[model samples]
Target chain A: MCATCGCGDDAGTRVSDLDGTVHDILPAAAAPHEHPHPHPHEHPHDHGHPHDHEHDHGHPRPQSPGTADAGHSPAAEGRTLISLEENLLAKNDLLAARNRGWLEGRGIQAFNVMSSPGAGKTTLLVRTIRELAGELVIGVIEGDQETSLDADRIRSTGRPVIQINTGAGCHLDAGMLQRALGALDPVPGSTLFIENVGNLVCPALFDLGESARVVVISVTEGDDKPQKYPHMFLAADLVIINKADLLPYVEFDVERCVRQARLLNPGVDVLTLSATTGDGMDGWLEWIRKNPHPAAAAAGSAPRSGGLRV
Target chain B: MHELSITQSLVEAVLDRTGGRSVTGVNLRIGPLSGVLPDAMRFCFEVVSADTPLAGATLTIDESEGRARCRSCRDEFVLEDMFLLCPCGSADVEVVSGRELQVTSVEVA
Candidate 1:
């Protein structure tokens, strides 16, 4: 049995040398002296040493049946035994927590707005900000895969805005939103709107730590959109059927869309509105006003629900 | 398109679970209506796992059949793509399966 570490009789005990090479000591009787090789041309034994080192320490040299190098083999095996039970999305969740705290600290209610490419999310946001400009301090975070075009549109309204270009990423994760939040310079008692990238499927999977998730589905799209994309409807706290002014020209059924959405999500609030004509804007604002963030209300001991945000 | 990002997340999840251990194979279940394309996911996995422990891991995907129940006819039938109609030719149908994306298991040593 090797005396270096404790490959001897007392196997359970830990042995330490002056050189900081900690090893497990096994009882000598428990250590069997079996032949290292059961097959020909196979490496007989592998001493617990790295492969690159050449200086041979005066240890019992097992016969080299074959020349298969076992360098870095022990380290690779050691990694398998490690129990690193960590959530894969822990980092993203950490950033999301920070964002939640930041939003709560400033009494700001953040909403994640998601929709298809041609859906008028930006236009609706612009109109809402314009109408509620003096009554509410609003900030916008525009997310897109490439350009700052959405942010530019929001900037035209003279509101504080930050643009986050995801480059090739399909959705804005919590980490990206956290960075965008910092750039927006969020003030206390403000309404922050995060216009997610123009995609329906991917954005529904990611949680940006928003108080509410509003999914905008344009009436120009087929009436069966809610049924086709049920996950988006299921994740949405509110569903907005935009481009209502075009309903007369397009073959769109507003009631059918609302019914399909409700079938998927019983509690989802459905609002039909045209961003261009500002029709049905009051319903959207009323819904937001009723659902004031809990953390913000608890901080100031305000009423649980009402037109708290003006 | 979005499946590529999800594929990257799956690779990351496998790497995180196996630590630095060399994974020989990864088994995943991809349903028919999961909105994730198996070919696209395999392509993305090959690129994302290049430097990670799952670099050479073989990806095994199990495909599921889309099944739905017709609300009007009360008949169950296999769906083809986005057509949620029952075999009895009814448009009112509720999906019962074929929208799953999950990591079933992994082989490592």
Candidate 2:
């Protein structure tokens, strides 16, 4: 472990209500269902819930298993060389694999929604939930650095939502997604949306085991976003050009943006929509409804009540 | 941004195999597909690892470019990103390497 192995100085993420009470979404075995459950301050020191850093992170560690190949590789001078061939993101990938398997076993379709902050991701989400929540068992794992504002907005939609305050993290890694998934078990065969932290680059590199990655780029932000942040567009399965209602007022060249996105990711599909005025939302909803497993559709029919399951 | 987290892993890796010895330097092989920029890694390593045992260790990187194979013509070439065209007029290609993000070795006293 690095001497700086602690999670952080910020509070762990909390699931809160639209009002003021912060709720902890615990598993059924952890405790009986209670509404507006206050957090237990699990990591009092803000040592973030970084599952990957749980290993011997603080001290100069002893010779690890990774050093076993040291004797094979040539050592020069008096320095004792250790051969540790390990990926920098091995831990995250490992957790992501587990998440993928878990979601597959449960037949849940997870989508990673990514975009810059205020690209109308939440607004698009609210509109989607309003249209599709009645048909499918939808859940959201909202990510933000600080406030529970997004979570509150999602909660008002009457769906299971967990706000993961990343503190200082720019992107949501797989381990965090795993924890959030445990907190939000949105039934088998349901659609789980992981609204990634608002960023373009970092989130592209970290995989959260999502079935598909949808990127949102509103017209007002810039038509050159795809050219500037190519990695995000390259990693996206579907790219949405949001806030098209402001197209007349904004000087965003939609065709050029799509061309740039295509240059980065030739296989990605593009869609335009305006969440504010209910324009082009049907296509987005149809895209969400088009791909779920047939069995998940049957499972969505189960008895549903109390939008917030306490 | 995410480099801080990745740098932590690098330092953690170094300290883990250090065996309580003073680390002099580290050898890393970062592939193009690894999505890690060398500059960002160096900057973050300096900031986040200052308090760790690997504080003074020089990070030596062996950068590798991304390689891809054309799906249609089976031609091999260097890849910058997902978007590329083969000399054989084929835009269809699959990545062969450059996604590596590894710590190959650590030097300690």
Candidate 3:
């Protein structure tokens, strides 16, 4: 099934390249992607017990006090209460960790760009690629429920791009990236931008193993967006106020939006820019140039959780 | 909703941990800032867990309040909403709790 939202079958999730070559993301057990790293599969705990207990379901088990109607109890007759203490998103987190390690190991700086639909994420990326054509090497991974339209736009910039259609899935999970990395194979020392599906809520919840998260909001989207989507802002490392050229016509309070974003994320960087008009584009480029690659900082540090399995 | 996916993950994790044993109860700890609605999760659990080892299992969610600690004044306080600001006028605050989404325990037979 779809790893992120589980609405459709896994066969619906797919990755397509500019050449029109499509790759199906199979179920986890028979996933087509291969692991480059030879790290062993690990779980928090694996309690192996012999299946010697008899199957006894004849009578109704005695329920604990106060749980008879609720059918919930810490201990029940002929039942084993196992304390799992496991994170619900453990599988996604594990895949994300592997992606992070692989990217950091190659000194690749990947940014997860998220915004609502029509927030101009593709516009910003296309502009960035054209402006910094020779100065930087950039690649992109476009995410959407369907269609390769955004990927085609990035392809026009002549950057290596891959499009992931989530089908019924609302957001892209780490598993999708893990599969895309095999195709993109981003060069070392290059920049990778993952354009997440246009949703303010679910995208922030999944960590795609990006070095940093960038949230883009346009002037037409109202200044109270930060207040409305606190999780997205709080998880953002930088917030780009796009479509700044419409500031005069629209009633977007830039100062108030920045203040609210900072309130949610104290250290978040806010930049105002109009991708179409090229106003304030220099600041955005400068921020990208100044941003440190996680690989460089983690050169001498111990590997997270012992080692990463990619 | 995202809760559907989350509920699926919860059921899968419990089944994997319990080795596909018949489960009667699954306890979860959800924090307010985790971006998950407990009611939606409960509903999704009932839908996804059907016909699986967790069929008819009760999903007990323990919702926790958002808590944070101010880095400037070292004061800990509750976050009534999404704002991370502290009473001392310092926006530099660290979330100490309320982002939990874990399966604490499961009753399997």
Evaluate fnat for each of the predicted models and list the values in order. 0.05, 0.54, 0.62
Error of 2 at B105 (Å): 1.3
Instruction: Name the lDDT value of residue A136 in candidate 1.
Output: 84
Ranked by TM-score from best down, the candidates are: 3, 2, 1
The DockQ scores of all candidates, in the order shown, are 0.13, 0.40, 0.53
TM-score of each predicted structure versus truth: 0.67, 0.80, 0.86
Q: What is the TM-score of chain B in candidate 1?
A: 0.92
Docking class of 2: acceptable
The candidate scoring highest on DockQ is: 3
Stretches of candidate 3 off by over 4 Å are: A4-11, A26-73, A299-310
Clash counts for the predictions, in order: 14, 7, 0
True contacts kept of 2: 0.54
Q: For every candidate, how close is chain A to the native chain A in TM-score?
A: 0.69, 0.75, 0.81
Give lDDT per model, in order.
0.66, 0.71, 0.78
Residues A257-306, candidate 3, lDDT per residue (tens digit)? 99999888877899999999999999999999988776667742222120
Off by more than 4 A, model 1? A1-94, A296-310, B16-20, B29-39, B61-105
